[model samples]
Structures are given as C-alpha cells and as structure tokens.
Target chain A: MSASPGVWLAAIFTLAIYSFLYGDNPVYKFSEHLFVGLGAAHMAVMGWESMFNRAWTPLYTKGEWWWSGAIIGGIMLLTRWFRPIQWISRIPLGFMMGVAAGLSARSAIDSQFWRQIQSTVTMKLNTTNNIVYVVIVVCTLAYFLFAFNEKSGLGQGIKGVGLVGQYMMMIAFGASLGSTIMARLSLVIGRLDFLFKTWLGVLK
Target chain B: MKILRSSVPIWLGVFGGSIVLLAMFIKIPVHVGLWSKWFLEWRVILASFALTLGAGNLLRIHANRIRMKREAWMYSYVTIVALIGYTVLGILFKRTHPVYSFIFDNAYSPLSATVFSINAFYISSACYRAFRARNGHAAVLLLSGVIVMLGSVGIGYAIWPGFNTMTQWIMNYPNSAAMRGMNIGAALGIIGVSLRVIFGLERGHLGGE
Candidate 1:
C-alpha cells in the first residue's frame, strides 16, 4: 500500500536478508555486502567527525597546541598501512593501550570488585530468598577457584560448593539464552509488522 | 630505528599508564588532573583513528578480491561502490542531507534489524539441539529456560499465573548471583592483564619480536 521509495527499498532489503533463512543465494550475498560497505563507511564518517571535533577543531580555532599531539598520534596510526613505517604506529597504540589499561584497571577495581563484594557482603540475609542468593554467590565464586586440591578436606568441601555453583551458572546461562531469544524474536516481529502494516497494508 | 621500533613504545606505555593510574589516586596539583583529562581525550582521538584504520583494511581486502576476480568478486564491487558512494555522499552533503538520511533509515536500519532478527531462527534451532535434559543439571537449565521464555509471553500467563513468579525468582536470585561471581572473576583477570601491559610484561601487543 505504501508508495514511498524509502519504504519500498527497506522492504526489498529486509526480504533479501530474510532470504538467507532458506539458503545462501545471490540476493542474500548482495544485501550482505551492501550492509558491510555501508557499515564501514558509517564508521569512517563517524571517525572523521570525531577527529575534526575533538582534535582538529581545538587546534585550529582555539590555538590549543596540546591537541596537536592527538592529531599527530592519529596520523601516526595511518602509518601502519605503510610497511616501512609500520613501527611508528606502535607509539600511538602504546599510548592508547596504556591509558585504556589504567582506566579499566581503576574502574574494574572499584566498580567490579570492591563495590560488588561490598554489596554482596552487606546484604541482610533475613529471608530464605536472601539466604539462597548469598549461598549461590559464594558457591559460584568457589567454582572459579582453580588452586584447590580436590584430595584435601577443604578442597573437597570447595568442590562440593563448586558443583552447586556450576548448576547455578547453568541456570543463569539458560535464563540469558531465553532473554536473548525473546529479544531477537521481538525484532523479527517488528520487521514483520513493518512488512504487513506499513508496506502491504494487510494489518490494522 | 631500533629504539623507535621497540623501546620507545614500551617506555611511553609505562609513562602514560603510570601517570594516568597515579593521577586517579594522587591529585597532586591541578595539572595532574588536567594532564589525565588530556590523555583521555587523546585516547578517544586515537580510537577514532583505529576505526578508520579498520575501515581502510576492509576496503583493501575487498578491493584486492575484486582485482583478483575471486569467487563472488561481483559482490565485492557492490561493497566498494556502496562504501565509496556513501562516504562521498556523507562528506559532501553532511549526515543531515535528505538523501543520506533516506538511505540510512531505509537501507542500513532495515538491513541491521533483519540481520539480527534472523538470529532468532538460528538460536531456536541451537536451543533444540542443546537444551536436551539428559541429566539433572541439563534438566534444571532447560526448565529455567522454558519458564523464562513462557513467562515473558502472554500464552504463559494463560497457562499458569505461577510462571511469572517463578521467572522473576530465577532471574533475581540465581541469575544475579552467577553474574556477580563472573563479574568479580573477570575484574580480577582484567586487573592482572592490565598491570602486565602497563609494566611492559605483556609485549604481545607490540606484535612480532
């Protein structure tokens, strides 16, 4: 029912992608390649905009010499394409990695480790559900302990705890899988809704 | 050349990482904080360059394939044309152009959504093969999965009101516990690896010796 060119284009591409469900074919291949091309171009455009806004704009307009370092680092990254000057790329790579490592390590310590442990330990285990949660958490942590010798008494106890942890994790994974399937199914439904309602006018 | 090739990078990493790490804990004069902020910005700029590099690499590979007339070479032409065409359009008219927006909304958005939607079928087939209740653990996992899936939909409510309650309990308690445990383990691993990289003990990123 829709005469819009955009709607028509979308319908064709959507059907082409869905065609993969039957089997690999030229229609699917063409769509897939187009998707990759568009995706890469989008990324490059974003990168260019980011460089212009974050690095070039500051250096050019405000005369902030400090940002020149970033521009130099970015340009150095392109040297990776040239075989003779590939090693020059490592300087920027190292700088990026170092800063990332520092930031991640710091945040992981606070948010992932300390905050998580603090919250878990401080939880009031008054109810049966609360007790179960604490037990599961402790058991799951135990499962990851690889240093324990299973022959020792403490190790045997740990092994028992680890088994419970394994089961809990399996249940967790199953729940996650169910959640993922539902999310994907929702997307499929949305696509179908577009096809039926917007494109074909088959649904109210 | 040798120093530029190896030692300088290691020293730079050590200096940059140490300064950033120290700045977090030690707010030495106002300059340290400013320096750290600058470093963070530099990281973002460098990351943008990395994205561009990745795009360039993809272009190169596809261009090579087209040149060689390899299997499915015609598709490579489609890719290159689309890539170059979109990039040119974006650069010349900017992202706000009507044509650019039209292509993105109709072509890119639909393509991305359909690609992800197709995963629902694959995941269902995988679940069928893997969700067999051959043992107690498998049974537990399968039961949890079934409850969650059903409880999320209207049909499950019609089947049993208790399904929703069970789903909520599983997600809140057991799932949260497992995720917390995994997060802690992953955090420790990150700390260890990051420290190694910071100290130049992990030279793997430097590529071949």
Candidate 2:
C-alpha cells in the first residue's frame, strides 16, 4: 500500500517509541514528552471549544443571563493561585464537587448496588450453573469478612468456604490477566502490521 | 463572625448539589423552570475551568523546569512549544484542518499505541517468572491462565477444541461470580463516599481558606 507523508512520520515515531523496549534512550524520551504535551494541549483546546459551544452560545445568543453566574464562578476557580481570594475559588470548586458527588452516588447506588442485588436475588437456583454462581459469590464475600474468630468450628467452616472462594478468585484473576495480555499483544500486532504493510512494503 | 469560614461554603455546596440532584429527579414546566436547566448548563461551563486547572498545572511544572535549567531541560522547550503550537493551531485552523489532523494522527496516535504496546514485553517477562506453579493455588491460577490463553488463540483450537470450552466455563462461572462480589463491595464504598461529599462531611475538595 502506498503511504502518505503523515503515515511515514507516524512509522518513524512508532519505531522511536518502540526502542524503549530495549532500554531508556533519547528517542523514547522525546516521543514521551511530545505525547504528554500533545495530550494536554488537545484537552485545553477541547475545553475552549466546550466553553464556546456549551456556555458562551447559550448565554449570549439565547439570553440566558443566569449563566453569567457560572462564568463568574468558573473564573473564581483561578483565584486558587492568589492567597487572599483563594477562599472564593472554593465556591465554584465546591459547586462542581457537590455535583460530581451527587451524580456518582446516584449512578453507583442504582447500577452497582440495586441492580446487582436484584440479579443475585432473582436467579433461578434449579440449574447447577446458577447454584455455583450464587455459592461462589457468597464464598468470595465471606473471604473479605475477618470478624469471626478462626479457631471456632463455625469460623473454621467459614474459613474453608473462604479458601474455596480464594481459589475461584485466582482463576478469575488469571482469566483477566490472560485477557490483558491478549489486548497488549494486539497492540504490538497492529504496529507490526503497519510496519510491514505501510512502511516496509513487505506484506500486503 | 466566622460565617464565611464555617457556614457559607457548606451552604454553597449544599445549594449547588441540590440544584443538580433535584433537576435529575424533578421535572418542572419549561416556561417556569428554565432556571433549573440553567444549573446543568452552568455545570458544563464550570467543568471547563476544571479542565484548565489540569493543563495549567502541567504547564506550570514544565515552565518551572525550564526556568531552573534542570537536567535535560531542553526537552521542556519541546513540550512547551508542542503544547502552545497545537493549542494555537486548534483555535485558529480548527481541529479538522489538515495540519491538525496530520499532527494528531502521526505524532499523537503512534506514540499512544506504542506506549501501550510496550507493556506487552513487560507482561511477558513478568509472566515467565510468576507463572511457576510451586503451590496448589499457584497451580490453579497457572492452569486457568494457560487454558484461557490456549483457548483464545487459533492454534489452541487446532490442538484441542476443548480448550475453548474450558476457558468459556472458567470465565463465565468463576470470573463472573468474583466480579459480582467486587462490584457489590465497590458500589457500597462509592455510595458511602458520595454521601459524604453530598452531605458536606467531605471538605477535602474545598481545600483551605
């Protein structure tokens, strides 16, 4: 495949970064610094655009005067650098902080707690798979509880169950690790594909 | 006497939080409740400033590095230039412009992918040492990992189709169960933390006066 100038530059940068696998070097450092700068710069540009489209347009064009409060508040955030007015920045900072807490709490409670309990409670235990799932979940949760004295008979039983839970966790974690390796390998494969097809013209 | 120090910020936080939380659950007539909608829009504006704080911090660090002439500080110049150059280009020419996309595609994309991909080598190295099954628990983990790996690849299926089924069973049952337990625990923690923030008990974000 014929490659463009941009593609050639991309290939060069990719190789420069890949050199880090062997050892730390100037090329890797250069690429790393450039990447950091680019990422931050992109975020700043996006923030500007967001302010324009989302904040500025509604306030000026639509005559949403109350938005001026937010604009003022957002500016106050900059006062964090100045000592006297730093307290004022907390007004906006607190506003955003409260909003975030509300949003996250609402979602977490709904999606994670309520929904999961619903699923667990509604399961049909007639099937072996369903039974095993419930048992494993119970045992896993038991592993986290340390209140029971291990020397007691009941505590020993719980410990035994928790040990089974531990084994199950290891298997699950192993699968997760396996999946991560596959993902990482896929990235390598993608780079190798580009090198061969786009840069070297070795493979079609 | 100490209203500003003690009460005002808490009231502000409560008021701001109530505005957002109420809007989500309560629906008001558009004509009368335009004010409620304004709070959401205000949030977006306020959020942008938070974005500025992050970039500003990064710039401050690099600028300080340059001023002090720290070792390899020459790289700081490259970072500053790239950051300012890209931000200016984006504002002037827009992100869709050829030069912007070219820089993004070439400089940013390859670097990101390469960084992530480099982890593959470390993981492989770590796996070689860690996967040794000296104990029973380690044996189970290694067995699961091997089965999953072999099952995922084509060569594994070529060798034994049962590898895939074994992997499917392990993931679907044990993995799902463990993950569910973790989710429940994490969600409870999130709820506790969120409540603390909403109730003004967590003043950590407010910093200091």
Candidate 3:
C-alpha cells in the first residue's frame, strides 16, 4: 500500500519543518523563507479583498462616495514612508485613534466597569464549591488591595487576605505554566505521530 | 509651541472618547452602534498599516546591522537575505504560484515548526528550575504539572488510566478558575489602556505629539 503524491508532499513538508529541532539547517532555512513569502502575499491579497469588499463596492453600487473617506484614510496611512509627507499619515492615524477611543468609551461601561462590578458583587456562597470560590476571590482581591497598611489595625485583615491571595496566585501561575508546557509537548507528540504514521507508514 | 497647539491626536482622543461614552447610553440608531462599529473598523484598518511600520523598523534595524558590520554579521546577512528574498519572490511570482507556494510550504512551515520545537527545550529547562514544591499549593501545582505532562505524552496512559482523570480535574477546576480570573483582569487592564489612549494620556502612538 502507498500514499498519494499529496500525502507524500505533506509528510515531506512536515519532516522539513520538524528538522529544525535538530538545529539550524538547510531544510529549516528553506521552509522559513517560503513561509514568509507566502504569508506576506496572502496578507496583501486579503488586504486588497477587504478594501474592495468593504469600501469600493459599497461606493460604486450605492453612489455612496462618503466611503472614499476610508480609502483616503488608508492611503494617508502609507505616508509614513516619505519624510516630508510623513505628517500625512497622521490624518489616518488620528481618525483611527478617534474612532477606537469613541467605540471603547461606549462599550467600556458594559464590558469593563459595570459587568466586572456586577460579577464581583453577585457571587453566591450557599454551596461548598461556591464558598471555596468566594474565599479565593475575596482573598485574591484583598491581596491586590493597596489601600490599607499590612502592619497593624484593619491592615491585619488586609494582610491575611493578601497572604491567601499571594498563595492562590502562585498556585494559579504554576498551573498555567504547566498547561502551557503540556500544549507544547502535545505538538511535538503530534509531529512524532505524523513521522510514524505518514512518513514511515508504520502505525497504520 | 505652534506644533503643540495643533495636536490632532489629543483633540481626537478627548472628543472621540467623550462622544463614544455619550453614545453608549443613548438609544439613537444613527449615533450609537454605527459610530462605535465605524471606529472599530477604522482601528483594524490602521492596525494593518501599523504592521508595515513595524516591518519598516525591522528593515531599518537589520540594514543598520549590515552597515555597521555588527557581531554575528553573517546571521544579519542571512536575515536580510531571507526577508528580501521572500518579498521579491512574492511580488514577482504571484503568491499562489507554485514557486511562491513552494516557498511557503517548504520554507515557512518548517521554520514555524522549528521555532515551536525550541519551546520543548525551553519548557524543560523552565520546569526544571521553577517547579519547586515550596508550599502546599505549589505542591499541588507541581503534581498537576507532572500528571499533565505525562498525560500529554503517551507514557502517562501507559502508566495509569487515572493520569488523564487527574489532569482533567486539575485543569477544569483550579486551572480554569485561575485562568478566567487572570483573563478578566487582563481585559480590564486592556480597557484601561485603551481609555487612556482615548483620553490623550498616552500619546506614544501619536509619534510624540
């Protein structure tokens, strides 16, 4: 039994990519260059497609010349190249900044401030699981609270909370690190599996 | 002084932020949602342009390296060559062309794999150094990491069926809660940073305006 040409090609490419684990070599170098070239080309095409779809067609079809502002703005963004004309880029930059600021301002209340406060205040501690969560949250929040002194008075309560938060944060960070490690290991394992099944044809 | 007076970003940031804030609470169809969407779209467009700015910076830095004959000049040459080679090939041969695809398939894919593979070694070293069981929670973290690592490999399954269960429990319960909390905090920080930019406190993007 044999695989198709496409399968072989995929296997070869996979091997070529994985070869980099051995160190900097010809296969890795070749693959690296190819990736950059293709990625850049893909991005350019996508940009053009976006501009045509989002900006140009709407204007031509609906007689909405106002959309040309976007085009002009985009072109202005390119002016960062020319020394004297670099200032022109600021036009697009400013427009973008204005729009982003405006949008974020509108959404911040719902997404950031209000929602966070609501979630923070609305936790139920009736169940054992909920009690544990409440404790973690309270401790963590207290750990971050810089308003009180840690040495005395109400500061003692704050200090206790801070200690719990510190421990919880440490544990959380370690777990996060462990998960990230596992993910990388899985990728390597997948590559090895591909080597065996696809390249060597030993598995299947 | 004249330049300072005509600062466009500051005006845009302040006025735009205020308008957006006002628009958020408003029910008007014309002024609220569309305005925010338009702004987001513009930001995306601008972000694409910023990528070019980043590339230009990369080129300048590398070009300067070549000119100065810096240490490991050969690596710099290689970097410059690789960058220029890809740019030219894509421009000349059309991206979808077999030659361009060959470069992407053979060159880029391999490099990406190679970079990711380096993470394997780094993780090993980092875990070796950092996975000390100094406290009770630290001990749990260490044990969970060991299980997850083993389960991720084929060896954990060979050792015991329970490794998978333990890893799942650790991830679902403690890991998810912690990750969610961190993610929420990050979101808030990001929102704050964006707000600062909107209010003209961060003029770094304005190129020192």
Best by TM-score: 1
| Residue ranges of candidate 2 with Cα displaced over 4 Å | A1-3, A146-160, B5-7, B18-41, B134-136
TM-score of each: 0.95, 0.89, 0.77
Let me know the DockQ for model 2: 0.65
Candidate 1 residues lying further than 4 Å off, grouped into runs, are A150-154
Candidate 2's residue-wise lDDT over B77-190, tens digit each?
788888889999998888999999989988899888888888898888777665788788778778888889998999999999999998899889989998887787777778
**Clash-forming residue pairs, model 3:** A17-B110, A30-B107, A31-B106, A31-B107, A31-B108, A32-B107, A34-B103, A34-B104, A35-B108
lDDT of 1 at B85: 92
lDDT of 3 by residue, A97-170 (tens): 76666665546557755675576567676777556665665566666566676677799988876687766666
Alpha carbon RMSD to native, model 3: 4.3
True contacts kept of each: 0.79, 0.72, 0.32
Q: After superposition, how far is residue B200 of candidate 3 from its true place, in Å?
A: 2.5
Q: Model 2: how many Å of interface RMSD?
A: 2.1
How large is the interface RMSD of each prediction? Answer: 1.4, 2.1, 4.1
lDDT scores for all predictions? 0.89, 0.81, 0.64
Give the higher-TM-score candidate: 2 or 3. Answer: 2
**lDDT of candidate 1 over A1-204, digit per residue (tens):** 999999999999999999989999999999999999999888788888888987899899999999998999999999999998888999988888888888888888889999999989888989999899999988988898888789999999999999999999989988988777888888789999999999999999
- On residues B103-192, what C-alpha lDDT tens digit does candidate 1 reach at each position? 899999999989988888999998876689888888877888999998888899999999899889989999998999989988988998
Rank by DockQ (best first): 1, 2, 3
| Isolated chain B TM-score per model | 0.91, 0.81, 0.76
CA shift at B194, candidate 1, in angstroms? 0.9
* Candidate 3: chain B TM-score against the reference chain B: 0.76
Worst 10 residues of 2 chain A by lDDT: A98-107
